[model samples]
Target: MKKKIKFMLLVYTLFLLSACSLRKDIHSYQKIETECDEIVQYLSEDDTEGLKSMFCNMTRSSSEFDKQIQVAMDYFEGKVIEHDPFTLKNDGSSVENGKITRLYSSPHLTGIVTDVGKTYEIKFYSYIINTDDEDKVGISKLTIKTDNGNECIIGEYIR
Candidate 1:
């Protein structure tokens, strides 16, 4: 029947659309994971410029950005011996008009735990906003602390 054929076509079209969306989500997840890895590498190498490049323009331009980065570098010293990969905890995305308007994530576990002479825990919050006349992206918040103390040696929150 024509009705049956039309219904099948409709289902097929919906399936294809969902598949595309799923692929895009996976791609975004992979990208976030890669970013996490890059952050760890940058910290381990004490590559200030490389780490700065990862942040959004808004964050990079902040007056305290350099100072905050220096604090983190000072607190985390020596060669990093070990680190854990990103464990996604909370994540969300907003899509409008067939485009992603915003995306964010906070990993379940601390971003990284490294043994560089001392144990250090790093945590981060990251987001991306894509809209007309406003584009904010990359790691928006970061914290670095030694596991032996309660003090947060390095904290940077950029809006």
Candidate 2:
């Protein structure tokens, strides 16, 4: 009877720990999703200052960053008509509780930056928050990978 009770207690503890972890993961994903949405909105509006705030300090000073933003704004402004919500892809390496946290680690969000004019692929990068608060997430990077396979890192806020 004593052994059975100990085993049950251990099982309960494991279950609680698993539940807490699951909640934390969900919260992190939600935070990233929200940040991505804001980024898209800023880009669509051609709000250069707003978009610049999301970039890391180092990136903001780069000449390439300014050029990239200008190109993106020219393509996206008054052209984007719809925003598709971001989704996670399973790389098949890490899986837990029928879900994979790896997918959430660096989720890529794509959207149509134009509808009638030339279309551009807008890629948003989601970074996991390293702070003590697990519920926080932020956009660490942005890119516009052209058809020539050339990619530009427009924004980076990873710290």
Candidate 3:
């Protein structure tokens, strides 16, 4: 009877641990989606500052960050009229003792935006997140483009 009880306890503990891991993964996916939503919101409003605030400290401090934002703003015409669901290109995490020590993800967002009477194809080709530094726990790389295939704004601040 004691052996059976011990076996049951072990099983229960294993179940709990697995559940916790699953919860963490769900949370990570949700966070990524939320960030994608924020990107769309800021872009639709043409809020440069708002967009800037979404990036990591490293990116925000870079001299080219402003230029990247300006380029995107200049290229991406108007409010987002429609967008395809954000695709989770890559997602990974390093967990130590049931806590996430590092996390990374790349989400791709594509949509259409209408400026006066014309619509343009807008694509946030890459939204990268690498949470290795606690102080800079935000987007490390971002790329935005319009229908013009050759023109793109890229912001890369990796640490």
Candidate 4:
């Protein structure tokens, strides 16, 4: 009887652990989508301050900053970006490995002429919040398009 109780306790602990992990992962995934949408307002006005307001207080090192910026930079260059958020169609089993793997694809921007004598290619236009940081959520990396819809990875270095 003691052995059976121990086994049940172990199983209960494992179930709790997995449930917590899944909830965290799904919450993180939803955050990415929210960040994408919130960044849209900043992108429209080219407002870096607006972008900063959207972050939920996160921090990062310089190198990490560059990596996230690249994600945006690629989009600004007229590349379509698609994200694979753990949804698979061809698997025989329905359950995943309990670990969420992200797949990023495509570019989300197109080269377009916004007005006379001005064409724009998006540099990194989306603002992503660093969910793990407490003070860096408002931070955003960026680049911009030149008159001919060409991208310049200048970032908020200027604006």
Task: Give lDDT per model, in order.
Answer: 0.70, 0.59, 0.69, 0.41
TM-score of each: 0.78, 0.66, 0.78, 0.40
Cα error, residue 58 of model 4, in Å, equals 10
Error of 1 at 154 (Å): 5.6
CA displacement after TM-score superposition, residue 78 of candidate 4 (Å):
12
RMSD for each model, in Å, please? 2.9, 6.4, 3.5, 10.6
Off by over 4 Å in 4: 45-49, 55-134, 143-159
Question: Best candidate per lDDT, number?
Answer: 1
The per-residue C-alpha lDDT of model 2 at residue 112 equals: 52
After superposition, the stretches of candidate 2 with alpha carbons farther than 4 Å from their true spots are: 77-79, 89-104, 111-120, 126-140, 145-152, 155-159
Which 10 consecutive residues of model 1 have the lowest summed lDDT?
150-159
Candidate 4 achieves a global lDDT of 0.41
What TM-score number comes out for model 3? 0.78
Given candidate 3, what's the lDDT at residue 131?
A: 40
Local accuracy of candidate 1 as per-residue lDDT tens digits, 24-76: 78887887878777777888899988888777666777788889888877777
Q: Quote the positional error of residue 23 for candidate 1 in Å.
A: 1.3
What C-alpha lDDT, on a 0 to 100 scale, does residue 159 get in candidate 4? Answer: 13
Could you tell which candidate, 2 or 4, scores higher by lDDT?
Answer: 2
lDDT score at residue 151, model 4, on the 0-100 scale: 57
Clashing pairs in 2: 56-156
Candidate 2 residue lDDT tens string, 79-152: 46765666664211234565534433444565555555544455665444323323323344677654446665
